[model samples]
Target: MDAKSIKEEKAELEIWQYIFGFTPVAVVKCAIELEIADTIESHGGAVSLPDLASAVCCSPSALGRIMRYLTHRGFFELHESTHKYSNTPLSLRLLLKNGANSVAPFLLMEASPEMLAPWHRLRASAAPGGGSAFRAVYGEDFWDYASQNPAVSKLFDDGIASHATRAICEIIERCGDVFEGIGCLLDVGGGDGTTLRYITEACPWVRGINFDLPHVVCVAPQIRGVEHVAGDMFKHIPEADAVFIKWVLHDRSDDECMHVLKKCREAVPKETGKVIIVETVIVEGEEDEYSDTKLALDMVMMAHTEKGKERTFEEWDCVIKGAGFSSYTVKHIGSIFSIIVACP
Candidate 1:
């Protein structure tokens, strides 16, 4: 009731601004769908509201409101006097024509109804034995739902491939030494063989086996040095000098990952083989932007999959050691993910 107390209360309430922050995501998703970034770029980097709206086929007034919010969020830069808009550094990444590095597909996929619906049931899913919130919302699991819906399936695949193209290219360029002397490399759960193709092309001496579910492998693109093999990873993985599993194990529970790693152990020679895992290893300590993003992804995994989650270094070590690996090394690729090489 006092003036100082009222001021303190108002300051505390400011924290709520970030608590209900879905608006930025929704706005970015809409801009991506409308190709607003690309439109501005195509028009030589700036356009008035009316011109931009005409290009995006929307009402000038409606688009203006959206652009104002986006500009406030730093995604777009608005010229005060001219009312022309240009892409900011943040919005530049949403340009669809940017190709592999463009996150448009990934953002669009995450913002899709099929993906967003799960968050509504997060309370139930977080309960003991409740399983995925996605399942809670859709009656079936995420994978099964995607399998049945062709459009959703393509969106999922394209989104993953877009990210993988950039990440795998970086791995090949910066860490190509990881593949040296490897006679053969098996990419377990390699969807579409995009990563394998990149690896084989980068290291011509290394043969590649693209292994995945039957349905996934059936439509895999033809890559000359990579062989498409269809099978379940939990049951069996093709023999290889080095086994590469990227963005796969995180979709499994500890027990499930242990089973798949056991299969990987069996597939390679005990003395000479190594298994490479690419995944997000949660960094603890300060609440910086990178860690915050990683934490958000952890929630996404929790909501979308049966038992998947982002793990910390200690948690990853426990699973690797439990799978009977004699030694392992962790290499942080960048802020987003890490590479774990485990040897039997």
Candidate 2:
């Protein structure tokens, strides 16, 4: 019987770390639901445990424990001597509002009970002919469920806005040229026009049509220089100089994606029209933070969508060519999403 070396013992502990990976998710979800970061921000950037507990209606000891874990997780900074907690850069980004890029709504949506339910069925969802985890739980399409549940719909829309805002801002900052030379831009599955509002704000000259289902567009607020139009992309897309779809295509299978792409192709001009697709391009053999995120998102797709998963560049190439596009150029924008411009 040989004794384990120090390195071997540390390697053995890695499995325990992996086992504990899901613990923070629940803790963070609880903190997010209580608006812990927002409370700290509202308190002029720091607060004592008792004050935070009072603000959020939690017991001092319980809130202190939560804050202890959060501070260790790099979410908050703890001043040990004074016993005050302050927002770290990571926590500031979780603020509900008055923050540059708030990710609170998106995180909250994923943390909600309904969203978590699908994850519970992940194993059964993998069985032959069992269908998606979400369908197994809800017994309906995601869009249909959202349309039926107003509260869920609102959360979803807010999540989309929160999730897309940072990526859109980065794209506009680095790849603003994509908006130029466009007279009319139609945002497919525009999701309350969050993406359009960002784009039109940057390029005021470009008129925009925010297109989605009637239920979705009905809830969308009116934005200057952007019209909310309701329609089905599978059947017809409103004619535009260019069609823009961000984080939309990955929800459908290849055939459905091809159908929408063809519709987009038909909506634009033959000579110079293009469809701007903003999605994850799964680069093969890439092992990095971005790839890790993309892969995790692929699992999310499996749980949430019926037949959707993140795709490699090769998969994207097949869909683009199947849509009858003459050619497409891939631009690695300074964001996780790649911009694929498919020409008619």
Candidate 3:
């Protein structure tokens, strides 16, 4: 091949990456809004562009663009002979109505313009003494804002539930053995006890306490065989054989995390108890794409909240041991996140 051809090819690949990357996410959000997956699924298996547009109540021209993009991205498969679009593996996983592990909620939550717009103001938040982009733009903290907005709160909760649906399965599969001996477990900041509920149903002998803010717990529907405790993790955590903190610590500063760890230490007995933390330990090596995604998520945490970012193993160890924990174990759960067991 000629030099110009190779350069052109590289440039084309870069352009495709940039264009297709954002376009598909927007299309995904559009699909959610239009209930496209549900519509197509309801229509047997595949649907023509015209039918899909009719079902979704959008113009055929615009719908064609969205469908074409999705098909190219492998979210939907287009049969060349008949021009029908079928749900691909990606769309099937994202189907909101009856998916085995629906990520629709999380996708919708993050991709919404309200959430995505904040990234634009990230530079301002990076200024000295600046707060998170959420606070800077909305004039209130995320939790505080959610407290007043029912729709937004539900969206956030549903997103967390969706996350738990996928991550909890891996957690149990890889770290299921960790729960074997524990009599009781506490899920700190566990919304609606999704993770705990999954665990309790999996292990009938073990009981769990779902601990969170009073208002959050107040709104949580009572799950069978789980105790709902309303309290602040920084101030206190209900006593349990093992305290589980899933996707919680990354949203706080080192100081705040330490305080939380100290409180967790108080909640469980020293000899037999441990604090199980499910979070990303930003490690070197491994799949470059996966690590980059982890780093991007850390930037999201940093941009959206004060004193929050993903940490490394050394960072976690400092906080755990500083909080008086004797030892800790990092278990690769094979999910997007990992588990850290800290013994007091």
Candidate 4:
């Protein structure tokens, strides 16, 4: 009611926003591992802190700090009676083993030291015409490390599969018509055939080829009805009616992407063929919070991997034409991904 009181409340709210935003990322990650969200929900809204700690295999006293932190962040609701906590809608969305928006695996994988280590040298990576952070840290590129290290490779592969499973399912249901009349489909750089499997299942009449490195394909599991072809995309791709380059081009420089696209163009006949590319076309002046996330990803690509980025629609057109394609059609696929079908 008073001017002083209102001013004090406004200042406190602003301070809380900064505090919550900075710390919740770590706490939310911990909650995912502990299944704290599911545990509280299983209790039908509210759960005592002691019971929550017991479910997560942590000492009650030690867990209390994390619980209080999350409660302050609005992920958990604290009850005065028993000092118990309840799940907020935000926490429920992150439950690893369950929930409609299960981003737990993606969070864990991306938040790992292997992925986060590059950020430590982000400033250097952002310097004028710098190389990737992976090269800076490991003295080698991502594919080189993935080929040599099995554990790291498995983690990266599993994380992609987990995210793809959910995302591909939604894409198929929403944009299944895109595959109609597609005869032979080549999945360029298709890691382990996860997307290929989804495509085959959705469009039964279409035959598919899973193309990636020989090493990755050597140990890759067989997917029925889809042929596995391992080779270099820069060299040549097998002939096909349609070439599906999903999330592949973003990991390379403009020259490198042009080379790959040219090779893809050579593989498919212009009159009856197309190259389907799935990636983000970053739009300038976008006001969405996720736009910032896309920019952050672009930096990650710059730091840890080879030249890659979230390009805008104009950039997409320029790159496609640079690769010798006459025109292309872009379609939104999933929340953050887009499908661009380029034809010469």
Highest lDDT scorer? 2
Report model 2's TM-score to 2 decimal places.
0.94
* Candidate 4 similarity to native, TM-score: 0.84
**Model 4, range 8-47, lDDT digits (tens) per residue?**
9999998988776636667777777788887777887777
Candidate 4 residue-wise lDDT at 319: 86
TM-scores of all candidate predictions against the true structure: 0.90, 0.94, 0.92, 0.84
lDDT of 1: 0.86
lDDT of all predictions, in order shown?
A: 0.86, 0.88, 0.84, 0.80
The regions of model 1 sitting more than 4 angstroms off are: 1-15, 79-83, 95-98, 286-288
Give me the runs in candidate 3 sitting further than 4 Å from their true place.
1-21, 95-100, 285-287
Worst 10-residue lDDT window for candidate 2 reads 91-100
Tell me the deviation in Å of residue 3 in model 2: 15
Ranking by TM-score: 2, 3, 1, 4
Per-residue lDDT tens digits for candidate 2, residues 234-334, read 88999999999999999999999999999999999999788999999989987766887889999998888888889999999999999999999998885
Q: Taking the tens digit of each residue's C-alpha lDDT, what string does model 1 give over 229-312?
A: 999887778899989999998888999999899889888899999999999898677555588778888898888898998999
| Candidate 4: clashing pairs of residues | 48-84, 133-303, 282-311
Give lDDT: candidate 2, residue 289.
67
